[model samples]
Target: MRKLARWHIWLGWLAAVPLLIWLGSGLFMAARPIEEVRGEALRRAAVPMPLSGLVLPREPVVATKLALVDQRGRPTWIVTDADGATGRYSARDGLPLGPVGAAEARELVAAAWNGTAALSALRRFPRDAPPGDLRQSRPSWQATFADGAHLYIDADSGAVLAVRTRWWRAYDLAWGLHIMDLQTREDSSNAFLWLFGTLALAMALLGAALLFRRRRTATGRRA
Candidate 1:
């Protein structure tokens, strides 16, 4: 009985350090805000761009096309989709500025050609509009640009209403690291987390069983 108890205690102690380290790190990360981490990663990944001459557009323009225009309206970096169904992103900053849908595509064309209501609204609205004005009732995704800019596009409407950057680069970087794993799909990456969790549970169960066996043997000896 004594030998069994001793073994269980030693084994439990042996597992304790790694378990604590893993748990503590996880809890600390969870408690921290996501935005801070994401911002940090963005800062690290950011690349500088030249202020002069014609800017070149980035590849994979199928997702989004980006063009840099000067005050005179001459395009320095003209990024547009050949199919015209997708959006365009600036090669310099990777900031998506245009999206294409039936209505959205028309809006983009009008904004580019006629300088209509949509363009007027976009220009009039504060670049960093108040949170209350931008709040929506639906789920949406936001992306940070390489030039420390942010673009919030409505998922349902596909309208980009606001674009600006905040100083929380570290938070954003941390979030990106936490959510992005090497796996192609997010679910597969999550499986690794579950695997570690299961290991911890099995270790706990084995420890409990050893303690129970020790108690039983001691009781039998006394009886």
Candidate 2:
């Protein structure tokens, strides 16, 4: 009985830290507005696609998903093939303008942002196995505003992909801690967490059993 109590205490203490971290981080995440963390409120609205003057290629471009996306108030055709190749072309003559550059990325974000914050930093990532934010569009630009807001623009399409704020960073950090992944902060499938969780559950059940035994003994003594 004493041995069981000791094991339960040890396991409970071991599990307490992670449980508290999970609770604290979850509370903080819930307190912050999701929109603010995602930086949606700071983004500029995409203008309507201008299809009136569009001159699409008569010779069909074999693509899986092709559509007109707003590019700095102009209509631009975003083409993606079955092989997952994407490009931005001039709607005027179907001329391939190629991927968007750093300048265009900045322009795209600035035009849409209603905030007075200036573009503080701009970086282009290659389209090959990029970071988590640019995983969908490998080659993308990360435009950081002076207000600590980051706008991810697809390099090929000149489209704003995602907006991230400092609040998001905090939330992301908390999530990483909760999942026990500090480096990439994404590996929730780790075995260590599972092992510790199981131990904690076992500890709780054993403790409950001990309490019930003690209560029954006290009742017998009183009677």
Candidate 3:
């Protein structure tokens, strides 16, 4: 009984060092703000996408082939088939175009074809009464363009519910750092985290083994 008690105490002490380190590190990591980490990561992950030319419409057809120019001014074509018919070699990488419903097709045209006109119409629409006003306002979602323009979407139907102008602010450098995991978003998904955990566990186990061996040796001597 004495030997067994001594062994347990020794094992626990051996495990104590690694156990302490693991607890301390985990507590520190958990204390960090997730939002700060996410913003920094977004900033670091930022990269410019190549600009493709705008697709211009040719006719008043429900759907038309859109003409586009690459960054180098080279022309490329994409079919904006809105008719919802599955026609081969139409556009979007030779995918079928057209045969879509009239209403959906119209919405697509309004969004892609008449970008400027759509913005103007949205601006002219009267603003909904604020919260607690006499008139009830419908809930909506919104997307902001790079040029400070906003396209309010219907939350339920995912439709372009409205369009308007709004403020725009770019993410700060810290956000980029967080996104990249360079400064803020600790590379928790990487092998390093796993390595650390494994090492900690191993150290704890090793300490326990040392304690057991010591107890066994002491017991044999007493016997």
Candidate 4:
């Protein structure tokens, strides 16, 4: 029982570290509404897509999905084929438009950003090697603002992929700590996580046994 108590005490301290990380991260993530954390208001308001003189894709697209969107004051048709390949075309003339170039990517970010700080830098990330701030595997352009806000644009589709702030990066770190996967930040069932979780449960059981034993001893003394 004494050895059990000592083990429980040490294990409890170890468990407390991750539990506190989980608690703090949960509070920080929940402090603001999800939309605000995502910096939705920093984006320009959407004008109704003007497709009055609409023309469809000339080539036969085995389309799995399609969207009519406004691209830099022009109507664009974003097409996704059955094999999950995406393409962009002009809705006005059915002409092929993207794989977005750097200059156009700059224009796209400028038009989309409604924040006060001016754009400080623009960088590109390859499909295989992407910024940690971005969640997608596709190639992208990152427009960074003076305020530490980063807006990611799809290199192939010219779409706004994600908006991340400094706080979001902190949240991401917290998530990695909470999940015990600081490397990938996605693994929830790693060996370290399971081992620590088992230790925490054992500590709790040991604590309960100690409490029960003390209560019974006190009752017998009173009797």
Candidate 1: RMSD to truth: 15.5
Which tens-of-lDDT digit does each residue in 1-223 have in candidate 1?
Answer: 5665566566567656646655554565676556543333322222244565443545444425543443123333444356533334443454454533345433432332311113222222222443332333432334433454544444333444344335333333333344433332234247544555555566677678777887898999999
lDDT per residue, candidate 3, 99-217, as tens digits?
33434433432443223323232211222632111122433333334444545433222223333332111222222222333333435455544554565566566657777888999
Clashes within 3 Å, all models in order: 29, 3, 20, 0
Candidate with best lDDT? 4
Q: 2 or 3: which has the higher TM-score?
A: 2
lDDT of each candidate versus the true structure? 0.43, 0.78, 0.38, 0.87
- List candidate 1 stretches off by more than 4 Å: 1-22, 29-149, 152-185, 188-195, 221-223
TM-score of each: 0.32, 0.85, 0.24, 0.90
lDDT of 4: 0.87
How should the candidates be ordered by lDDT, best one leading? 4, 2, 1, 3
Candidate 2 minimal-lDDT segment of 10 residues: 129-138
TM-score-best of 1 and 2: 2
Error of 3 at 60 (Å): 18
| Deviation of model 4 at 43, angstroms | 1.9
Model 3 segments beyond 4 Å from truth? Answer: 1-22, 25-187
- Candidate 2 Cα outliers beyond 4 Å, as residue runs: 50-60, 128-137
Question: Using TM-score as the measure, which candidate wins?
Answer: 4
Better of 2 and 4 by TM-score: 4
